[model samples]
Target: MIVVNLDVMMAKRKISLTELADRVGLTPANLSIFKTGKARAVRFSTLERICRELDCQPSDLLEYRPDEVPQNV
Candidate 1:
């Protein structure tokens, strides 16, 4: 399962969800979905905006952790 590090990043930057949404020109509801990692897709432009506003790299916003694959019995 993919996990969002938004809470962690926000803590590190001391930025609130509303703050991030305001900076990124997105609605708090939309940003909240992204923040919670419930988003199925993200636009490149949006990603760029987010990175710029957050002063962070894409990798900072996202991470990959390989989970154990289920094996057939």
Candidate 2:
């Protein structure tokens, strides 16, 4: 399973959702969905913007947990 580590990275960078959203040119609501790991899919462009604003790599934001089961499964 894939896990979104957005909140962790944001906390490390000391950035708020509203602030990050503005910097990444996305609405806070939309970013919130992604941050909460409720997003079914994400665009690479969005990931690039997020990584750029957070000053992190894509691996820092996403993680794989093979032990976890998918909710829908």
Best by TM-score: 2
Q: Residue 2 in candidate 2 has what lDDT?
A: 84
How well does candidate 1 score on lDDT at residue 2?
53
Clash pairs (backbone) in predicted model 1: none
Off by over 4 Å in 1: 68-73
In model 1, the worst 10-residue window by lDDT is: 64-73
- Candidate 2 residues lying further than 4 Å off, grouped into runs, are none
> What TM-score, to 2 decimals, does candidate 1 have?
0.80
- Model 1 score (lDDT): 0.79
TM-scores for every candidate against the unseen true structure: 0.80, 0.92
Residue-wise C-alpha lDDT for candidate 1, range 1-73, written one tens digit per residue: 4555777777788899899899989999998888877787789999899888777888888876678342221
lDDT of 2 by residue, 1-73 (tens): 8889999999999999999999999999999988888888899999999999999999999998898885623
The lowest-lDDT stretch of 10 consecutive residues in candidate 2 is 64-73
